[model samples]
Structures are given as structure tokens and as C-alpha cells.
Target chain A: MKNRVVITGMGAVTPLGNSVAETWEGICRGKSGIGRLTKFDCTAHETRIAGELKDFDPLRFVNKKELRRLDDFIIYALAAAEMALADAGLASGAAEGERTGVIIGSAIGGLATIEKEKEAIFLGGPRKMSAFTIPAVLANLASGHVSIRFGAKGPIGCSVTACSSGACAIGDAVRLIAEGHADCMIAGGVEAAVTPLCVAGFNAMRALSKRNEEPEKASRPFDRDRDGFVIGEGCGIVILEALPRALDRGTRICGEIAGYGNTSDAFHMAAPPPGHEGAVRCMQAALRDAGMEAAGIDYINAHGTSTPLNDAYETEAIKTVFGEHTRRLAVSSTKSMTGHLLGAAGGIETIFCMKAIDTGMLPPTINLDHPDPTCDLDYVPHQARKAAIRTAMSNTFGFGGVNAVLIVKKFEE
Target chain B: MTLEEKVISIIMEQLDVTREECVAEASFIDDLGADSLDLVELIMEMEETFDVQIADNELEKIRTIKDVFEFLKSRGTVWQE
Candidate 1:
């Protein structure tokens, strides 16, 4: 028999907030976390605004000496993992070291460190490069650092599927636990790619919003005036435990991982396929995996990226999958407030789904003032809604034509 | 600064140890609490600060603070007493 996985703990270090409580509060209040790119000099870049984090200090989670050696993404991942383990009431040494694992995801890990080292090499000589650069810049170090910190010895890995990375990590964690490879897994995604090169590169591709004057209202998902996604950075992590173990320990079950589906467009490097066939298949796969029908899902946390093509295509995909039930479904894009977290989007959004399942509150798509005619749907706009969500789905579509969907449901005996 | 003083400061900063702990006979790994990676980083810092390239073969010969001082002195590079 396949083991069931339950989410016992959740944590997030987001642009909206530093913790789950703060982020959820901002989501419920329709507050915008997007702002000017203050981390670096964006004078040369066309896209100046981003969902940059505020008032985050690594010292609270890591020592000063060690913090200097780690990249910002690794620090964020470590902080989120620490918060998750604590929330689960599991001491770092409580679980069997061999049965506990970590699988954190990132699209571009340690880009800041790489950029700094490159500058050093140019200004000074090759000898000026720091020896810690390799470990600090590798994408897998998010999981590597977490495993070493928490003493989790089993099946440590990382997923790097761009924007879908986090959701894929969670999905992989569920499979690991279901296959009895691990009793518990610390899984999610972290990203800190809000550096000069990342911003300039995205701007070159015209993938970021250039709304410098109005940063708060910049990420208007599914709106007629929406231009492109606003690049954001953060981390989100959750503790996935076997349902039986969680029940045996009397742990609080926030939600259950019912299904996960990952697919590829295989058409374009950066654009969705025609008719969003991949996304439709991806959602259908998730529903099939959960043994659920489209009508069974109570709400959908969309992958509404606030981009022109993504929003319209995702809407079409939803209409195709949910059919007539699309009108009644409470679909919203938390990215309207959080902006697009890229790799960390799926992790944080899944937590939103869990929050909706636990608290019966549907987060709103904040900046959906004038919805596009083609993208018309009930986006739970403007304010939070009080609705009993028994089953929720979160969607994440990334560059490289990757599509990932996760289904979560309220736990019951 | 003198060569010894400069080398000691670099070691202290890179390894995150105290001045008193960075004695001449102190081993980078044992007394200074530096792992292999830390030692490598300290070497990089030393190279950048002194503007001298320490080759890979020479790194294996220098394991102690005194060894580092002797290596730099033998390089015939400009240094103060």
C-alpha cells in the first residue's frame, strides 16, 4: 500500500512577508510586496521594479562567518527549513537521520555570488576569486546545506525546473515518502536571483515589467494593462510526513498532498504551446492522480504570472479543464500581491492553498481592477473571501515550457 | 605593515580566529580551526593582498603560519622587515 503524505509544517520567506503569518496577512489584506529594485543600481535596466524582500537578516538564522560563505538563496532556504522543522515540532535530531531528507529547488542558485566573483576576477586577477564560490554558487547547495544543517542523510537532492521548481520539489517529496524512501522530507524552493545580471537578462527578453513609477500596482495579473511578470525572490518550505507517523505523533495535519502532475510544452523555449495543451494535460494528470474530477476542486491558486501570454493561456487552460465549473471556482493569483517568485512561487503558493484549506479564506488577486476580456474569470478580486475550501490546486508554469500542478485537500480520518 | 603582521591579519580575518590564536607555529587546520576550504580561501586572500601568486605545488608545503611567512620571504617579493 502506498503511504499517504500530510503537510504538518509550513514556512515562507517572501517579498510579502518574512513568515507564513505575515505573508498570509498581507495576502488577505490585498497588500502589494512589489517595489523598486533597491538591491542594486537599476539605472541601466528598463525593468526597475521587482518584488524584492525587505528587512531580512541572515544573522538570525546563520552565524556571521558561515553566512558570508553561503549565497543569499542558501541562506533563505536554511531559514525556511529551520522555521518548518520548528513548526512541525521536530527537533533537528528527532527523526532518524537516514529517514529524513531534503529536496529544495532553485532556478538560478547563487547568481549573486557568481556575479560578485566575476567582477572580482575582472578587477583583480584570477587569484582574487573566493574558494567558496563553487559551493556557494551550485544550485544544489540549497538542499545540500539543509541536509548538512539538519543531519538529514536520506535522498538529498534539488529540483531546478525554473518557475515550476518548488512545486516539483514538493511533488517529488510526496513520491519519496509514498515509496517509503523517507519518513519525512523538507522540500520546497528558494530563489535570490534579483541581481543585476538576472534583471538585465530578463529585461533583454522583455519578460519583466517596466513600471518604475507605480511599483505597487505593477503586477496586475490577468488585467488588460498587464505587461509582464515582475521578478521576485524568496523561499518557501514545508515538512511532509507520512500520515501514519503524523497521526502516531499527534501532529497537526494542515493539509494532505493528494496529487501532483508535471508536463512539458516541448514547443518553445520560453512560450507556452498553442491552446495550452500541455497545461490542460498537466491539470488533467493531477486530477487523475488524485482520483478527482474537475468539479471536485473547490479553489485554484493559478499560475497567473501577470504576463500577457501566460495569463490568457492559463485562463483558456482552466476553462478547458474545469469546463462549466470554471465560473463557480474561486481562482486567484497570489502573484498579484507577491509578484512572480519564479522558482519559489510554487512553494509559497502551495502554502497559500494549505492556508485556504485550513482557514477557509481565499486569498485575492489584488491588482485585477480591469480584467482582460479574454482572461475573464472570477479571480476572487479585491478582497479575501470566506469560503470552505476542501480541495485546492496550485499551478506553476515556467520557462523551458515546464508545467507543474499540485492538488492539496483538507485532511480527514 | 610588516610581512608577519600582514600575514597574521589575513589569517585572522579569513579563518575568523583571534590574534592570539594565530601564532607562528599554529596550524591552519588545528589551531586556527580552518578546514580545507577555509585554508584555500585564506590562500586566495593572501595572494590578493600581497599580490603574489602561490602555485599549487607550493601550497602543499605551507601548512603553518610560519610556513606561510617563510614561503613569502623566500619569494624575494617586496616586503618590510
Candidate 2:
């Protein structure tokens, strides 16, 4: 009998908006956050547009001294964690310390810091580097700083599994609770890699969308005219506590993490295999873990990266797993609005799932003007819909062929 | 600004402290709450701002703002104050 893990709180800072409330509001209203890329001058690059965050003030979350030493990714992680702890009523020492943990994941942590320090070394030799450069650029330092901020002493780690990093962090947090290692965990993913080098590297590999003329119409997942994913930056986090502990504290339970699946295609570095067999098995594994049938799921928040390959193959993967029940699944790709947040996608999309289960409203896959011939699922398109959904699944597939599926459902006694 | 004012501004910005607390007699670590890393960053910033290099051994005597002022004076930093 594994311990039941319940989500007590959630937080997010996305291209759509800075807070969970704002981002979800943007999603519910079917607003697109994709815009012109201004982080760097991409005058010669093939892809220029991106999903950039707006008005994100890091000073509100960290002190000036610490901010000078910290990178944007770590700052975003800390901000999301602070919001999550406050939402969980643990910020003021309500329920924290030894039994709590933090695990933040990022596909590429501190890319801007790395780029800056490299320039420093070039301009004034290695002696010009700041003393805190190493800590600022380390991939695991996000979780390290988050743990220090909240004094969570039990288990501390970070996941770096490309785009699946955030989902893996949350899933591993669930494992820790079920294994009796922690009563609570602050888990999620963050990314702030929208720098010159990162964008150029992705463009060199032909990974990002080139729809610079009309940014809002760019990230059209499942549409026949879909391009590549628009790289975005943000963080998403949630507080997961054991059901008994949550009940004892009388906290408002958002949802229950019923099942999780982690798999890999092992075929490509950046592309999925022929039929998305890995995704199929991954969803099956989640269902098995939840003791659920295919018909039990009422909604699916698809990974839907808006890349030509991902949207169509993901559609096939859904059909393979759910079969006839795919017709009944209210599937939507909030990435249509939020863009592809990479490692942070899982954390944000998981919150979208919980919000769906709580509000009985399914977010839409915006800008799906022309449906692909291969993509035939009913993707709650263009407009948000109200549905009494009980169970929701979120799929996140990352580079290096990693796939993670999480099943969330409304809480029941 | 004078050399003394330039060095004090660098210290203030690097240490993230108030202007009033950065008196000449105040200790960098004990008074301004600077750790070893903060001292290193402060030295780097000062060196960059003044366009001069201070040897590592001279760091031992730089415990207070007065010591920094004297060190800069001894290194031929023109004291306009």
C-alpha cells in the first residue's frame, strides 16, 4: 500500500503571465504568449521569434546580494518555490523542515551565465571571472538554493533529462513520498536558456519556428501549417504532500497524483521513433500504475510541441493507447498558448491538469486553424470548454528520446 | 568623483550595504557582513574600476575601509579628498 500523494499547492511563471493565476487565466482565455525575440539580436538567425516572459521581477523573491551571484534559472526556481510554499501555507513555518524536500529540473540551466562568463574569460582572461560563477551555472544549484531557502533537509536533487526533466522531478518526488522518505516535497522544473548562444544553437540544429511575422499564429500545434516549437523560458512548481498529512492539516487538496510513467525511445537524440511506441508503452505503464482502464481518463494535456513530427505522432500515440476512447478524451495542447517551455513544460502542464480537474474547464489548443490529415483527435480547439473531467493525463517527451506521462485526478475520499 | 569616492562607491555596490555604514574605520567582514567570496568579488570590482592590480599578499591588510584607503594611497592613488 503506497502512500497517496496529493497536490496541496501549485505555482508558475510563464510567458503567458508571471503567476499561476495569470498564466491559467491566459490559458482559459485562449491567449497566445509567443512574441518577437528580444533577448538578443538574432539578425542573421533563421528563427527569430520566441515565447519570452514579461515583467518578471527577481528582486521580490531574492535579495540583491544573492541575486548578483544567482542566474536567471535559479532565480526563477526560487520565485516559483516561494509561491508554491506560500500557496501550501508553509512559507511562514506552517509545515516544513526535515521531512520536506526539493527537486527542480532544467534542460539547460544557467546558459546565460555560461555565455557571460565565457565572454569574461575571453575579454579579460580567466582572472576576470566572478567567484560565484561555478555555483551560478551548475545544473543542480536551482534545487540547492530552493532547499536552502525553505530549509527542506530530507532529500535534495535535480533532474536534467532534457525536456522530461521537470516531469521526472515531480514523478520522483511522488516516489519519495510513497516510499516514506518525505511527507512533503517542492518539485518542478525551470528554464531560462533563451540566450543568444542557446537560441543560435537550436537554430543551427533547425529546431525552432521561423514565424517571425506573426508571433501569435506561430505555435499552432496539430495544425497542418505548424512549424517548429517556439523556445520559451519560465518555471512551474507544486507542493506534494502525503494525503494523511494534508488531511491532518486541513489543507485544500488540489488533486491526487495517481500514476506516472517514464520511458525512452533510445533511437534518436532529438526526434521520436517511427510510431511513438515509447509513448504508447509509457501511457500504458501509467494506467497500470493507477489501476485504471483506458476509458477512465477524461482529458489529456498533450505534449504537442507544434513541431511537424511531434503533433502527428503524438496523435497516433493517443489513438494507439486509448483506441476508441480517444474520441471522448478532451485533449488540448496548452503549449499552443505557453509555447514549449522545455524542461519547465511538465511542471506547467501538470498545473494545467490540476486546474482542469479542479475547475471542470479544459484549456484549449489555440491557433489550430488547419488540422493535419494524420492528426484526427478532437483537440478542444480554439476555445476553452467546460467538461466534468475526473482524470487527466499529461505527456512530456524530451530530447534523447525520453518520455514521461503523469496521470492526475480530482481528489476523492 | 575623487579616488576615495570612487573606491567607496565600488565597495558600496559590491557589498550591497548602506552608504552610512561604510565608514573608514568599519571592518569589511565584521562591520559590512562580507564573507571571503564577497571580499574576492569586491577586490575584482575595485581592480576593474581603478584599472590597477593589487597583489594577493596585500589583501591581508585590507580588512577595514581605512586600510583600503591607506593601501590605495600607498599605491600612488591620487587622494583628492
Candidate 3:
């Protein structure tokens, strides 16, 4: 048997809130964080709304000098990591440095910084470039900065599998701990790509909702009126430690990471296969790895990105996996309230699964007044429901046909 | 503001230090806790603020506030005497 890994702490900086407690409260309340795009000028784009962070001042988390040298994504990652470490009560300096690692992923790193530097070069020639541009824009810097801040000297890396980046990172952290590479791992994802170029790119692909008048009602996953996803920016982090070590240290264990499955569709870059074969296989693999039957899963925090194709395909995948039990399962898409956080989706959604397991309250998929005929499963729509949840699964599919699924359950000796 | 005062303010802001810490004898790395990245950004800020170009070799010579002020003086940047 492999070493069991359990989640000891979690942190988040989402469009809904700046901490895990606040974000969970917002989720339970079914509050929508989507609003008009304020990061950049979206006058020419077809979609002008995004789930941008409100009142998040980086100075609260980082010093002014360090803030200027790091990108917004890195800042978000650092803040979330700090919170996670503090919650775990394991200061990086106090932990065995060689046995602690960090894996923070980002789909698009330093995009805002790149935009600024590119504009400077175009407007004022090459001499106008900033010296810290290179370090500020690299994707791995998110992990680098966190490791440096916490003094964690173990295996550190960043997973860049588009939207599945966070799930992949967390999954990889489990492998590292199982392999004895690290006893503790700080893993998560962060993204701050709500810039003009990102907006234009998604708008050009017609992958964004153009509901300018009603931003909150725009991201309606599984609903018949759903069009596309609303872009969001944030970070979510969790501290995973070996079960034995956690018990020895008397650390609080939120949940146990039972299994992780990752696969590639190899069909389309931006779209899933006709029947979501990859997603179905991913979930099955995770279930098999966890040594559990499909009927054992109590709730599912779906990848429902509020996009039409993703929602229908994910629903079909769920039905194919669970069959008759699909009707009994209470599946919800927190994205309905938080929007699609891209790479951070898997990380934040995983935390939501933990929350459900802890609280026995199933979060709702708000704005599902008229469900799509193809999506027939119970989505726990409109309002939160009270239910006993012991095991939960989170699914995340990225743009590059990458599918990742994780199964977490209530920890018991 | 005079050149010295302007330099002090920029150093204070870029290094996140106080005015007292920006003394002439204070070394950026030793006294002000600046890493390589901080030094590079400080140079860039100075160049933009003074509208003067600093060569790669000249960056090596700048170790202290006095060194930066002297380098600016050599580059024909005038200050209130």
C-alpha cells in the first residue's frame, strides 16, 4: 500500500472572496462574482464581462518592492500559499526543508505583464523594456516565488496543462509524496489573465458570454440559455501531507486525496470529443484507483464551465459513468457563481469538494431555471441543499483536450 | 526637487526602505537588502526618471548611493548644488 496523503489546509483568492472562509461562504450563499471587465478596455470585444477580483490590493500580501518584481498571478499564488501554510500551522522554516515542496500551476502566467512590456516596446522601442520583465512573466516563477518565500527546498515545479493545470499539479504532488520525494507539498493554481488581449482572444473564438447587461446571470451552466464561459482570475492552494506525519504532528486533516486520473483526448485543441470519451475514462480511472465503485461518490463538483458544449458533454460523461445512480447523485457546478477560473478551476473546485464533505451542504448551480434538455441530471439548482456527503469528485477539462479528475473523501483512521 | 533628493526618494520607493536607510554610504545589497533583481529594476527606474542611458558596464560600478549619484554626475545630469 502506498502512503496515504491528506489535505491539511486550504487557501483561496477568488473573484468571490480573498480567503477560503470567505469564498466558501460566498459559494454557500450562491453569490455571483461576475461583473463588467475593469482590468482593461473591452470596448471592441464581443464579451465585456469577467469575474475579476474586487478590492484585491496586492500590497496586503506582498511588499511594494517585491510586488513590482512579480506578476499578478505570482502575487495571487504567494498570497494563497501563505494562507495555506499559516492554516496548516507548519511554517516553512519549521518543516523539514528537504521534505517540503511547492507546486503552483498557471495556464497563462504573467500575461498582464507581457501585455504591458509589449505595449512599451511598440510605443517606445526596445529601450523602454523593464529589466524584470523576464522573471516576471515566466510560468514557473509562481512556484519559484512560493518556494523562496517559504524556504521549501524540496521538489518544486509548475504544471501548465491549460485549464487542468491545478488538478495536474495537485495530482503530481500526491505522486511525489507517495514516491517519498517529499513529506509535505503545497499545491494549487493561480491565474490573472483578465487582460484586453485575453478577452479579445476568447472573444474571437466565441468562447465568452456576451451578456453585458446582466453580468451575474451570464454564467449559467447547464441552463438552456447558456452561451459561453465568463473569464475569471484567482488562485487556490492546499497543503497535502502524509497521513502519518499529519497525525504525528496533530495537524487538522480536512480530507484525504484518494485518487487522481489524467488523460488527453488527442482530438481537438479547444473542443472535447463528440461523446466525451476522455472525460468518462478519466473518471473511471480515478474511481478504479480509489478502489471505489461509481455508486460510492456522493457529490460531483463538475467542470461545467458554463459553455454549451462543455456542460452537455460533461453531463453525458457523468451519466455514462454512474448510469442509474446519476439521478440520485447531487452534482453541482460552483462555476455558476464563481465563473470559469481557467487553470484555477480545478484547485478551487477541489477545495469546494472538501467543503461539501466537511459541511454536508451541497453547493448549488445558480441560474439554472431552464436546464438544457441534454443535461438531465439533478444539478442542485438555485439554492443550496442539505445532504450527507462523505466522498466527492472534481472534474476539470482544459483547452488542450486535457482531462483531469480527482477523488477526495472524508478521512478516517 | 534636487537631484540628490530625487535619487533618495526613488531609492526609498524601489527598495522599500526609509529615507534614513538611503544614506550615501549605504550599499544596495548589503545595507538596503536588495537582490540582483532589485538592483536591475532600480537602475531601470533611475534611467527612466532621469532620461539617461546606463551601460551594462556602468551598472557594475554602482554599489552604493554615492556611486549612483557620482555616475549621474558624470553623465551630465545636473543637481542643485
Candidate 4:
């Protein structure tokens, strides 16, 4: 049998709030974090609203001089990692270099930094660019910064699978622990893509909600009036420890990472297959990995991005996976509350799912006033509900037909 | 664009502060809370603003707000130091 893995702690820096408690409160209250893009002026763009991180005083986590060397995503990663480590009750110097590792992923690395540098190059001569420009914006720098900060000298790397990056990173960490590659891993996703170029690109694709007038109501997942996803930024991380290691250390375990499944649709670049066959397989594979039947799942954190195709296809996938039980399952799209966090969606939604299982309360899918007939499901629409949740699954699908499903169950301690 | 105005605008934007925060005597690292990267960005902005090339050797000695002004003056850009 493979070694078991359990989530010892969790951390999140979401548009809803800076800390996990604050984020959870926002989720439970069915708050909308999407708002006018204040990171930069988006007045010229069609998509003006996004889930931007607010009041992010980086001075709380990083030194003044050190802040200049890192990108916003890296700064968010370090803050979340620090919060996770503390929540896990592990001191920075407690773990040996070989025993700990970091695997944070991002969809677009440091787009904001790149945009700034590009503007500099166009306006200034070659000598104007900073020496640290390349390293600051690289996709793998998030993992590197976290590892160096915590001295986690074990396997340190990143995954860049569009929006499924976080799920892939967490799944990789699970495999590492199961295969005896490491004892503990800091794994999740971080993204800070609230920049002019990023917003303009998504706008050009018509993939973002143009409901700039009503920012909070812009992201209406599964609703008939749903338009497009609201791009968001933040980092969500969890401390994954081998079961035996966690037990030996007498740590307070939160949940078990029972299953991880990944697949590619090979169908389209940005849209799911006509029948969502790949999504069905992804969920089925996760169930197989967890050694659990379909009926065992008590709740599902759907990848409802509020787009026309994704919400409809995801509902079809759920029906295919659970059949009759699909209607009975307490399904919700926290994206309705936090908006679409893109790369960080998987990690943060996994955290929410785990907490739902642990606390026995399903978070609501806010603004589901008028649901689409094709997207009909429990959806825990409009209000939070108390339920007996034993096992929960979080689903994440991304552009380029990438899909990842994680089965996180209540810790049996 | 006037080089001084151009440079000051970039500094204000990058630091996310106002002109009051960047008094002429303000050091990039000390008063503006600019780390190494911020300084680099400032230099990059200066280079773009003046259409001048600042070598590493020239960049190494720049410390205070006055230093940046004086260096631009020496380059024949002739701004108030």
C-alpha cells in the first residue's frame, strides 16, 4: 500500500481576504470579491472588474530591500507559505533541508513584472532593464522563493498548466509523499495577474465579464445571465505531511489527500469537449485513486467559472459521475463568492472543500437567482447549508483542455 | 518629456506614492521604500526618460536623489541638481 498523506495546515491570500479565516468568513457569507481593477487603470479595457487582492501591505511579510527583488506572485506565495507553516505548527528551522520541499504552481508566472519591463525596454535603451528582471518574472520563482525562505531544500519545482497548475502541484506533492520522495511538502498555487496586458488579453478573447458597473454581481456561476469568469489573484497553500510523520509529530491534521487525478481533453484549447468525456474520466480516476465509490462523496466543489460552456459541461460531468446521486450531493461553486481565482482556484477551493468536510457545512453558490436549466444541480444555491460531509472532491479545469480532480476526505483522527 | 518630470513620474507610479512622498532629498531606498528592484526600475525609467545609457559603473555610485540629478547633469542632460 502507498503511504498515506494528510493535510496538516492550510493558508490562503484571496481576493475575499488576506488570511484564511477572513476568506472563509467571506465564503460563508456569500461575499463577492470582484471589483473594478485597481491594480492598474483598466478604463480602456472591456473587462474592468476582477478579484484583486486588497490592502496587501507587503511590509508585513518581506523586508523593504528584499521586496524589490521579488514579483507580486512570489510575495503572495511567501506570505501564504509562512501562514501555512505557522498553522502546521512547524518552525522555519524545524525541518531539515532534505525532509521538506516546495511545489507551487502558476499559470502565467509574473505577467505584471513582464509588462513593466517591456514598457521600460520600449521607452528606454537596453541598459535600462534591471539585471533581476528575468529571475523576478520566471514561472518557477514562486517555488524557489518559498523554498529559500523556509530552507526546504528537497524537491523544489513548479507546474505551469494554465489554470490547473495548483491542482497539479498538490497532486505532485501527494505522489512524492506516497512514493517516499519526501516527508513533508509545501504545495499549492499562486497568481498575481491583475495587470493591463493580462486583462487586455482576456478582454480581447472575450473571456471576461464586462459587467464593470456591478462588480460583485459580475460573476454569476450557473445563473442564466452568466457571461464570463472574473479574473482573480492570490495564493493558497497547504502543508502536506506523510501520515506517519504527522502522527509522530503529534500535529493537528485537517484532512486527508485521498486522491489526485489529472487528464487532458485533447479536444480544444479553451473549451471542454462536447460531452465532457475528459471531465468524467478525471473525476472517475480520482475516485479510483481514493478507493472510494461514487456514493461516498458528500460534497463537490465545482469548477464553475460562470462561463456559458464550463458551467453547463461541468453539470453534465457531475451527472455522469454520480448519476442519480448527483442531485443529492451538496454541490457549490465558491467561485460565485470569491470569483474565479484562475491558477490559485484549485488550491483555494481544495481548502474550502476540506473545511466543508471537516465542519459539515456546504458553502453556497451566491447569485444563483436564475439558474440555467441545463446547469441544474444542487448547487447549494444562494445560501449555506449544514450537512454531514465525510468526503469532498474539488474539481479544476483549465485552458488547453487540462483537468485535475482532488479527493480530500475528513481526517479520521 | 522633460527628463526630471519623466523620472519623477515613474518613481511616483512605481512606489505607489504621491509627489509629497518623493521630496528632492529623498533617497530611493530609504524614503521611498525602494528595494534593489525598485532602484533598478528607477534607473530603467531614467534611461528611458533621458534616452541615455547608464553603464553599470555609473549606476553603482548613484545613492541619493541628488546623485541621480548630478549624474544626469554630468551626462550633458543638464537638469537642476
Name the best candidate (by DockQ): 2
CA lDDT, every prediction? 0.92, 0.91, 0.92, 0.88
lDDT: the better of candidates 3 and 4:
3
Worst 10 residues of 1 chain A by lDDT: A88-97
Query: Per-residue lDDT for A257-338 in model 3, tens only?
Result: 9999999999999999988999999999999989999999999999988898999999999999999889889999999999
The i-RMS of candidate 3 is: 1.3
Task: In model 1, state the lDDT of residue A107.
Answer: 93
Clashes of 4: 0
TM-score of chain B of 3: 0.94
- Regions of candidate 4 where Cα sits further than 4 Å from its true position: B1-81
- Cα lDDT tens digits, model 3, B4-72, are 999999999998999988889999999999988788889988998888999999999999999999999
In candidate 4, what are the lDDT values of residues A377-398, reduced to their tens digit? 9899888888988899999999
For residue A8, model 1's alpha carbon misses the true position, in angstroms, by 1.2
Model 2 chain A: worst 10 consecutive residues (lDDT sum): A88-97
Cα lDDT, model 4, residue A196: 90
**Is model 1 an incorrect, acceptable, medium or high docking prediction?**
medium
Report the first chain's TM-score for all candidates.
0.99, 0.99, 0.99, 0.99
lDDT of 1 by residue, A1-413 (tens): 89999999998999988999999999989999999899999898898899988998889999767887999999999999888888898865775489999999999999999999999999977867888999999999999999988889998888999999999999999999999999999999899999999999988888888888999998999999998889999999999999999999998899899999999999999999878999999999999989999999999999999899999999999999999999899999999999898889989999999999899999999878899999888999989999988999999998899999999999987
Per-model TM-score versus the true fold: 0.96, 0.97, 0.98, 0.87
